[model samples]
Target: MMQLDDETLNAYLDGELDPVVRADVEAALARDAEARARLEALRRVSLLGRTAVDELSRLSVDESLQERVWPLPKPEPDCPAARTGRAMTILSGALVLLLGMGLGAWLFPSSPRLAGEAAAVATAWPRQAAWFHHLAAERRTHARPLVLDVEGSEPARLQVELNRTLQQRVVVPDLSDLGLRPLGARLLVEQARPLAQIFYQDAGGNLVSLLVALDSGPDTRPRFERVDDGPATAQWRRANTRYVLVGEPERVRLQDLVPVVAERTTR
Candidate 1:
């Protein structure tokens, strides 16, 4: 019989080995006190990780708790799973927004809270609503899309319902290779003008809203500001369109995605 090396034993513990190897390791563990202790330790770590994750999931409900970390509607207090999920939402979200702009959220003492809060509240809204408003306003004013299709495209106008309008907005990366999909085209408008917004989502359920506004550019670039104590936001202007992305206070993923939004708007 082959001696069970520590390396092979560890691989077996982590479930990285083949079934026969795992069986061998298990058999050895059953016979050896030392191996049994080592296996127990690994099991303990795995259990600890799962427990920590579960605990965090329980604490982050949208209810009016001591610190309502989340801005969305609250789940019933009786629903443990929803509570767990929402808590994870807030925890993960906080990690993202907080970490994303550490200097901005933590370092900036003046308006960090407001900037973060506003963006977070608006993050869930659909990009299509932003786009449709632009198109709809144009129809109402000049009666067309680009002053050509008077009466506006009824087919296109039918989109952007209140529910759709209320969907979460997000800033996404251009990961076309991963089979990621854009939210497609949606009309956007600000101040009664036409615009377009593209959206995308990732495996983690984070949504991004991107709009190509036809509205006049703000005289200045979008700045980081807090809104009602939610997430810190990065709002800026690229020539004509406005860029606003909001999320939890600390997120490396969102930070990495910001530049892609800028490039998309510019292009």
Candidate 2:
């Protein structure tokens, strides 16, 4: 019998376990309902991530997105556009590096110099997601009503309601299967891109938000990296949609919802 820890279990789910270890995990799952549930959740998250990444790989780089994130100065006839363009390109690259480092610092406040792989994962969007989550959480905390339910209770109903409000097809995950209930839906915008955020509360009164957006890039998916910044966020992508699960860092409970999200947001 192999004792399962977070690392081992994640490795098993990711198919990184060797034959003997994999068999041990399977045996453990045969007798442990909790282990089985966790395994299912990891599978869902992994599949959703891979799907998003594969789809993104097939598409070309979005020029509009490039302009939005890294704007280049306009060319002038009097000056050499090529020279200016090259200089601007170098400047833009430096900006991206500085931005990543800034985000890394914000994410790992105690350890600003994130090393190797973690440094690579420290990018712009997670920082933005964490910041947005912090703002929203603070607002909810200070408000008289800690949580509010503005519309439907179920996923389908909520999706319809949110679509009406957003004027777009917003996929709402049915988290009832995981003992989570929808509190309501809200809209937030970033860089003129509207995002649909669905709120859920567990029996323990823990709040989690699913922030969904229709914009993504080629490098977008198949990864559920945890952000330990202001909020413990589990981020992944599906096609053009990017989803972030925002929860309190103290809670550290959003990972369990990854599978539920992966399954329910298939549409």
Candidate 3:
């Protein structure tokens, strides 16, 4: 009898298995309660991911922020008036720049102030990781499901590829003991840094993600937080590398797994 592994069940659910194998799997599922449960778990996870993506798609951008990023164009006046307006605009912009520079210099005379601003931006990784976690879930539900850059079946290759891409040695911890199997991984660019996202799913079909990126900010221990009511995330920095673990709060207590993941990833 052919063993019903996750790969086989997943392929069967995806309609990717050959007819002969599909028939065999179906026949097995009829009598195998465990196999049936696994199949249902996969289906449930997929549905939840799609629902999350749909909710995200329906969200509206803040009107005030939208206007600031893309201001409406004013109606053009006569050529003479337009030229005059353009000159005035340039003159006003220069004045504002000068005034802003003067104020900044007065408020913060040291270069450390500028460095502090950059550090503030670096601290936004938690929110960024949460957003990308949703994005990955969305991609998974598409008709053509997202193809991982590195398949999870080969842990060695996944680690090698991620290390090479990130230019740093990193560990991909085995979460199977925690009932979460590695699904795959993808490389992403966030905040001008290379980010590696490793995807995982539990037996119940709950999705979990781990994101790794190079950090220039100070090191810190795991801090658990939620992002805009989406997923709960645990963020921490080890040395110069930042790690984020994202998952559905209702389904998983991401905080509990944070230290376990953190300890394993520390090399």
Per-candidate alpha-carbon RMSD to the true structure? 18.4, 21.4, 16.6
Cα lDDT for residue 167, candidate 1: 38
Model 3 pairs in collision = none
Tens-place lDDT per residue, model 1, 1-267, is 546676776687677999887787778777788767777787788899988986675443443552244233321343668668867986786677677767566444225353445443442222223323233333434432222211112323323431144232222235555333444445434335454444444455344444444333333334444344433345556554455554334432345555566665455
lDDT of 3: 0.75
Which of the two, 2 or 3, has more lDDT?
A: 3
Q: Please, what is the whole-model Cα lDDT of each candidate in the order they appear?
A: 0.47, 0.63, 0.75
Residue 232 error for model 3, in Å?
0.5
- What TM-score does candidate 1 reach? 0.33
TM-score for each candidate, following the candidate numbering: 0.33, 0.48, 0.53
Model 1 lowest lDDT segment of ten: 144-153
Off by over 4 Å in 3: 1-123, 140-144
Residue ranges of candidate 2 with Cα displaced over 4 Å:
1-122, 146-149, 152-157, 164-168, 216-219, 222-228
For model 2, how does the per-residue alpha-carbon lDDT over 38-121 read when each residue is reduced to its tens digit?
778878888999889866754546867856864434312324685588569747754665686665544443231332224234
Better of 1 and 3 by lDDT: 3
Ranking 2 against 3 by TM-score, winner: 3
